[model samples]
Target: MAENTAERIDWRQLWASGDLARFCFICLGILLHATNETMVATVMPAMVGDLSGVELVGWSLAVYEIGAIVAGAAAGRMTSYVALRTNMMGAALVYSAGALLCATAPSMPAFLAGRLVEGFGGGALVSLAFVSVERLFPQRIWPQLFGVISAVWGVAAFSGPLIGALMSEFLSWRWAFGVFAAGGVAAALACLAVLRGPAATRQRNDGAPLPPFPFATLACLAVSVVLIASAGVDVTPLRSSLLLAAGLFGIALFFGLDRRLPAGRLFPAKPLSLATPLGNGMIMVAAFSVATVTFTVYGPLLLTSLHGTSVLTTGYIIAAESIAWSVLSILVANTPPERERGIVLAGALMIAGGVAGFAYAVPAGNIPLILGCAILQGGGFGIAWPFVTRIIVTAAPAAERTVASSAVPTMQRIGYAVGAASCGIVANASGFAGGLSSQTAAGVAAWLFLAFLPLGVLGCLAAWRLPANSASPAPA
Candidate 1:
């Protein structure tokens, strides 16, 4: 069968639609979040160089995602009462303010506060962007739309890391955050100008009234992440273990409560199980996402310490994955539905391979091998992500499409949040907190890089469960 209606959909019409301006802003919202993530990674080594809390390196990422998870959970519910344009405008402004806070932070603890705030605004922007896609665009081109969304990261890959590298290498890293802060403000202004009409200002009744916001469910996730993240920051083996166990319970409680929500449920039914299509797809995203944080949260420090790579070089090296992902997603956006299953399985294997390669290549200090693995890991995700997403949204119950769409990124962030905390624990245990000597750096490289390999295996196992029958498009 034809793939996701893209072959029959008009590519030009998407750009020509009257909604183009809204669409552009949507992309801008995505750009802010994507750039902020990679840019921070590029600048992290420098941030630590000038500051303390090397042991808390993972907390930087953890706090950001924690903020994101909260905002993302609330974003869908916000749409029931808040206008899309208004929600977006408020979110963009908040994002800018948070960046400004980060840019001026005086110490590590202070900087983390900024990251948390920035994450809230950025997360809402992204989740709202997905809701906007469904609300504004023709259903015919959803696959194509997702392909373009994937390309946004590639754009960020070039711009975000470069800005970060430049700031870290030449000027102060604070300048990088300053530039993005300005970008966020610009996006907020565009929302006012482009979405001016009375029709755009009102809440859109896209479907039946959504349920009341799931406060109990949201609390479970918040508590879970806090306990898990706190466990690693001051790592005593016994205390950390206890916290980790408590955090896992939070996740369990979240799943239990979220499942019971009548209409305002955070996910489709059976979100955690692999039996249902939505669950299986979410599992795949979560596993691979958890498996990949080594590069983002820890890649720069290890590269600089092990090989004497400049910040710019490390940024570019990590940026390679983004490049590959964008190219592959664009290249394969139209694969017939029949082939999607095989592609998913193959891509899962490739992702695991690249992650495994990192454990060896990082410790060995081989530049070519490291770059090659990065490309493989990125390309694997690019190749598989759209199809995985398509399977998910396509399989969603007609009434719950919005929830399913927003859940896509929310699920991915959950993986990153858990992964970041796990990284702090492993890295600290490996003696990185004592500061890295060449000998210790190599050992940390081995442990840190290998830590998430099991997540890769788990993702591959989930990939095997993807239905062989082709799924259909979601309701328009």
Candidate 2:
């Protein structure tokens, strides 16, 4: 047990190998997505000052999620027909174009369109990167590599706010996007130079054409998020209730349609059930994702409004979570296979505690407490997520590895969509829509974090139900 627990790899070997370029692209792919997301989110408060979008914030996020959902679903199958290099370059170019559009957008509607496109491209990049990990890296180092991926977000934690503030305060919020747009372009060029062949090179051995795109499934996902977002924008007794239900139904419909499809499926078999490890893992992912995102959608605004915090400070405060997530993930990266189940469950408990911590801390207007809560939340996910991901990937049918790997981020976005929409509804109903004030801010802050407590609990339960054994690591 000691030997297994203490075992370590020559981490430098990862970058020393011929696969280094592929790995760099993979990291770049995530950085492109994470940095854009973080920067935009950081600058949103200032952006709204230039544009009238106080109410449309939820919709803005939801549209991006819709685009991401569509892109994530199709990215897996695209590899069957297109080379990974080409697909990555195309996705990066799309991201660059979207960022360019946003940088130049004059109206809120145009901004929304730009965000949708960015999400589509970013989602594809991330999904493809996930697939690359399975294909390019040895399984034993997955935890370390996943830590590296989390570390990218940690870098984003600092870079996002610093750059976002520099542009939003010193220049223009639009220029911030212009810089990141250039990054997407650079990543695209890198992809062109580095990667080769298709993602699932082994899967297409039968030499058959892939199935048609699942347009209906994508549409269902889009509509569901729209309805939920609409409910958040206009909270009412009957209207909001109906919209929420319909939105959830749309998600269920998407799964049913996806399962029935002959190909181009988004998730593994029995995705909605709890009987299988994949199902539990999915539920845990969705639940925890739903539980945590309220911080993202509402955290900065609330902090600025309630506490008179600077926008830059608020951004970093939010970033504290990402940093903690990275630090803890890297610390726990060496966990042996035998310890995965316990660690996952422990992480889930910590996550639940973090949400509860936010419930108390955010409303109380304590910066230190809020930051602590964020660390708790992020740290929990950091320690557990790689293991949870490994569990899901291992439990997945051999043929569905690509789909399963990609599903992690897809599920996270779905959960974020739901969480963001729900936050809007809770905030609006708490009189935040009336306008920001001390009393209103307190109410919104309290409910926004509290409302998701059930989701945290659900996450814990789902984690508890996950399978005990993970796939054995390859020999070092």
Candidate 3:
């Protein structure tokens, strides 16, 4: 009992000893990346309207997500070759350039190119931020730091839509991109300042030569996303089916090849299985992400068509989950270790319930119910995410901690890409491709939400399987 008590974290003391300014700067990096994503999602409709690229709008998100996933996977190892400060500053610069390109893009193709570039930088920024948490802070403070980062995402959820809508409505959507570009610059400058001196030297000394890039896996993943995205376009059923099959096969190939690789691997061993703590946590993250992202990808469109909801209102509704998640995470960030399993289970239930509720709420055109469901879903993730993250990071071998930390976001982005594509398929098949009418939108909503319920169930099972015991450190 004495030994157990001694190991418990003292949050206050940890914070007191920490460098607040440097932590803030690290949080800022992630905030900028998160805000850019939400802002683009909000402003995309206006951009498409003005740019006359309704058909290419989905491609924008698809390309960005694919680029982000690839970059995130590579970032874990990339940091090994470069100093964290140098790497982060370069990524921020790239993000700024991409935002500038979007601000001035003359056509959809150009805009898509910009999005891809933006995603690469944004993805690296996020993954590197996670890695920084492991390298910079003590294990005891991990939950608090993760909570702070979640708070930043919540802020983005609240502000991103409002900022994007205001810019698009009162000024021009181009101004929104400009705003994000400015944020990138600020993040870059902050990284330059805070990540210097002894800390910078420590990071560089710990790093190693860059390993081989996962080119084959990257190619497979990229092609899969492309095929899945292409299937969403107005196409014959047979062609769409073939595209979907090809994409699934590509994904299988990626996993197969990834498992065969010895050292320079993209994911941890048994990444998709529930047999290990890291694998269970990652699989849960992926499954839950896939189930929940249906709302983000298609909720706004369906609600606008069926319920006559304004774009701004729909954005807030979609963001309700983030708000709930942030609030819940802060409330439980310091939960005693003994209660971690309970929280995980409760969070999983909330997510599954929320997903099930959305299936009915959207088609019924019930605004309050839809918002409630969103809150439930978001709250669930908030409760579970920190604990899962802690387990995965702590369980990894010291040498692979960066890779393990980065894999959480990598899995999440992969899940988002796949979920978005899956939703597109269901929507098109359910008469959404013809037009965005109330009836078609409702049909799509029903099919989309229902299809994802199985994923939610699988997520719950994974969460339940997580070991109650603190994960043992991997063999050195």
Write down the TM-score of every candidate: 0.90, 0.85, 0.84
Give the alpha carbon lDDT tens digit for every residue of 60-170 in model 3.
Answer: 667778878877777767666677788888889888999898999999789989989999988888888887887777677677678777677778877776777678768
Model 3 misplaced stretches (Cα beyond 4 Å): 1-19, 52-58, 76-86, 130-150, 189-210, 274-278, 334-338, 390-403, 437-439, 468-476
Give the 10-residue window scoring lowest on summed lDDT in candidate 3: 199-208
Residue ranges of candidate 1 with Cα displaced over 4 Å? 1-18, 79-83, 133-148, 203-210, 393-402, 436-439, 471-476
lDDT of 2 by residue, 1-476 (tens): 88887677666776687565467666787787777776766677777667755566666667777777788767867777676667778899999999998898887779989999999998899878876777667788788777777667678766776677667767888999898789889998887667655443333325777687999888988888888878866578899899989999998998899888757777876775788788899999999988788777777777767887777776777677888787888899899888899999999998999999988887777888888888889889989998999988888777787678877877888888777777777878887777656677777888888888998999999999987778652121
Question: How close to the true structure is residue 354 of candidate 2, measured as C-alpha lDDT?
Answer: 91
The per-model lDDT (C-alpha) reads 0.83, 0.79, 0.79
Ranking by lDDT: 1, 2, 3
The whole-model C-alpha lDDT of candidate 1 against the native structure comes to 0.83
Error of 3 at 283 (Å): 2.7
Deviation from native of the Cα of residue 101 in model 2, angstroms:
2.6
Better of 1 and 3 by TM-score: 1
Cα displacement (Å) at residue 354, model 3: 1.6
RMSD in angstroms, all models?
Answer: 3.4, 4.5, 4.1
Query: Any residue pairs clashing in model 2, and if so which?
Result: none
**Stronger candidate by lDDT (1 vs 2):** 1
Question: Which candidate number has the best lDDT?
Answer: 1
Model 2 C-alpha lDDT versus the unseen true structure: 0.79
Output the worst ten-in-a-row residue range by lDDT, candidate 1. Answer: 2-11
